[model samples]
Target chain A: MELSGIAAYLVSFFTFVGIYAILALGLNMQWGFTGQFNIGVAGFFAVGAYTSAILTVPESPWHVGGFGHPFLVGIAGAMVASALLGLLIGWITARLRTDYLAIATIGIAETLRLIIANESWLTNGVRGMSGIDRPFAGVFQTLGLTSAMGTLIVVTTFLVAVYFLVERARQSPWGRVLRAIRENEPAAEAAGKDIGRFRLQAFVAGSAIMGLGGALYAHYFGFLSPEAFMPLYGTFLVWVMLIAGGSGNNKGALLGAVVIWSIWSGSEFFMSAALPDAWSGQSGPLRVILIGVLLQVILISRPQGLLPERAPKTVPFGKVANRKERA
Target chain B: MDLLIDLIQLSIYGIVLGSILTLGAIGVSMIFGILRFAHFAHGDLMTIGAYVGLSFLVFTGAPVWWALPAGMVGAALTALLVDQAVYKHIRRTQPVILLISSFGMALVLRSVVQLVWGPNVYSYTGGIQRPWWFGDIAIVPNHVWILLAAVLIVAALHLFLTRTRMGKAMRAMSDNMDLALVTGIPAERVILITWILGGMLAAGAGVLLGMDSRLTPTMGWNILLPVFAAAILGGIGRPYGAIAGGMIIGLAMEISTLYLEPSYKPAVAFVIMVAVLIVRPQGIFKGTL
Candidate 1:
């Protein structure tokens, strides 16, 4: 590959990693920080992506689109839309067993996918929505930055912002309460922390971050489709990333995203190059099996993850900040 | 008159579907009761059963009904294998970890099915069976066989639970783990039995579901939520309650076509599950052991 080609490839790859990293961090807040198991990451992702696509895209007869808002507005709209979905799911499943959230989330995701496919006027059905221009097309053109470069920059900005925000949340007393709930729920409840409320808050916050990732994805790809947000891509991959990188740690979430995505996308190239032409269709599932087995191996061999969560040095609600918090 | 006929017709269809859901939900209920985790891979287990049955049907060239036992055996062995290979290793960990692992297992099973079956739709028989007419109401021959098989299975299950010592032991374990352990119940044996039972019934459900509809790689996964709704509505851990839940969900989804779009069938199940969760969180049976 040429130098520019390699750079462009790297840019697109990192852009995807940045988006997935956002999702992983969001999940880290829920599962890693609070021990809420969510299997419906795709639902919130699709909602955010469709919300942004419909909001920012130009008028279209195929679907509901007339606003043609700015990219920031679309991204913000995506966040709000996904956050509301998060709130509904979190509220309903918070007081129940941890598994209830898993089932409920998957249900909502499946139902949402069905609705997207069936509701033709809303999301253009299975035919999908296209022409979702990259963020700030005019400015990027003037700046002489490639579209991929511009998207990577935007995704990186969001990734960094989300990382900083979640890290801050992880250090706050609020995060401590969440961790307390995860470690020992009865203890946290006895301490006068409303367990249900804290869980809901963490869930909603994570969902909003997933939404932001979805919006960035919509703009970066310049297309929107229900298939784009399958549970495999939107939810399962995020879970694998967080678990592989380090669930409780924010930096681990980022590292997992980049590393796993490379493995994922890298496998695609490998399969295409290695497999015979006649067996092309089988490769998709073959790749999935490889990754699926990888997940099982990781779970069995090193459930603690590549970067196991570091114990917070400062005691819960302690006034003195631990110097290691900066790490 | 037409509306009554429509209702009755839909009810018949519902009964057939209810039979399938009942078989599937029983396994889910048992697994959740005994294992203390929602078996996310149960749906894919159903798929494996259906495809296994398909393979049997292809090999034996017998009536499709004969495929049932073959599917049951295949699924039971698969379940035993899966439990031993994957779930057993993580059994000591939190139930939530099992849940995550099962989710991965669901996808893995599905992908493996696709690789083996080639993702195209298949049916047991090439030509459709003529529907039996009962005063303008239509019923297929396969539906009758499915209903009869379900009845026999349920009856056998009831006897096994009430008569057999092992069955009673299984019930006792689901009811109270500590007490069962104190009573010297072999936890491992009971757990393995639960997997076998769950797998057999899941396959039974899968094969019946295939008869009711066409078989696709995602056929079982598609109905996963509805099966869950049936289990949850009946009470998550109670097998008997799952029966009632299955019938209700099946009828509700079918009859709903009277007013709602057919595509919203799964939504009907979701709405019912959510409503049950909100209104009667313990389920109608209170999810008792």
Candidate 2:
């Protein structure tokens, strides 16, 4: 590959990784901290993508648009839309078990996809929505920087900002309460913590982050499609990344995103190069199988994940002394 | 009279579709009743069964009826293998982790099916069968067969649960696992029975559904939401409830298309599911979670 070609490829690759990291981080908040099983991450992502696409894209024959609105307006709209959806679903299934939420969320995700695919007036159906602008595309081009490189810079900076915010929340008193509720719901409830309320908060916040990631992805790609947000590629892949990277830790989520995306994209390159023409058609399914097997192996061997959550170092000495005395 | 005929025709369509959904719902509800966690791969297991039926029809040159049974057997074995290889070990972990494992298993099952059958849609037979008229309404022979098969299976399941010792033991296990174990019900035996029955019924549902329409790689997975809605609407552990729930879901979905777009049919099932969950979390039949 040529120098610029490699740089562009790397930029595109990192941009995707950065986008997925945001998704994984959001999932970590829901599943890891709140013990809320949200298997429908793609639904929130799509909501963000479509909301922004509609907001920023030019007017078309089918659906209403924001008439080429500013990029910030699109991003904010995406987050709000996704967050509202999250809150609605969260409130409805809040009292149910984690498994119920999982099933409901999956149903929600599938329904969202169906609506997006079928509702031509809103989503333009199968033809998809295109021609959205990247942030500062004109300025970056004038400065002789490639659009890919510029997008990567934007995405990374956005990712860093999100990471810092989530990390701060993870260390806060509210974060402690989330862990408390996750570890022992009864105890948290007994301590006067409104478990459902806190859970809904986590769910909403996480979904908003995912929505932001979707907005970034739509702007960076300069296109949006229902096909781009299929659960197989969108939701399940994020789960695999979160699980492999260690669910509870923020850094693990980022590392998992990078590592898993590398293996995922790398295998495609390897398979294309290694397989003969006849065998190349099966490459997509083969990659899926590999990830599936990897998930199984990881679950069986390292259920704590590669980077398990660290224990909080704030236990009272008096409680330890009391236990020691009783023993 | 014309409207009545249309309504009846829609009901027939609903019943045929419901039979398939009922079979799947029964399998899923049975597993949840006994195993105490959702098997996320259950839909893909159905997919595996449908694909197996297609293979038997294509490779072995078997008749559709015989191929359906062969598919059931194949799916039953696959379910047993999944139990032994994955679920059994994961049972030691939390139920949530077990649920995640099932998701992984779904991925594996789907990919394997895609690898073996490829992604294109296939059918059991080449030519479409003409519908048999029932007075003013019409139904396909496959629909009749599907309804018959569902009735027979549900009757057999009832007899097994009510009359047979193993069936009663399975019921006892579902009612109270600790008490059942203390009363000398072999947990392994009950678990084994659950997987076998669940697998058989799921396979039957898959093949029947395939026979009705065309078989796609995503046939089972796509139908999952409806099956789940059925299972939940019927009450989680009640087989009879699943039957009723399936019919309700099927009828609602089809009938709603009369007023709404055909594309929004699946959404009808979802809306019903959410409403049921909100109003009566225990389900219409009042089965425990």
Q: Each prediction's Cα lDDT score?
A: 0.91, 0.89
Give the winner by lDDT: 1
Q: What is the lDDT of residue B98 in candidate 2?
A: 82
Per-residue alpha-carbon lDDT of candidate 1 for residues B41-94, written as tens digits (9 for 90 to 100): 999999999999999889889888877899999999999998999999999999
Clash count for candidate 2 is 0
Residue range with the least summed lDDT across 10 consecutive positions in model 1 chain A: A315-324
Clashes per candidate (backbone, < 3 Å): 0, 0
TM-score of each: 0.97, 0.96
Candidate 1 TM-score, C-alpha based: 0.97
Per-prediction RMSD in angstroms?
2.4, 3.5
lDDT (Cα) of model 1? 0.91
Off by over 4 Å in 1: A315-327
**Clash pairs for candidate 1:** none
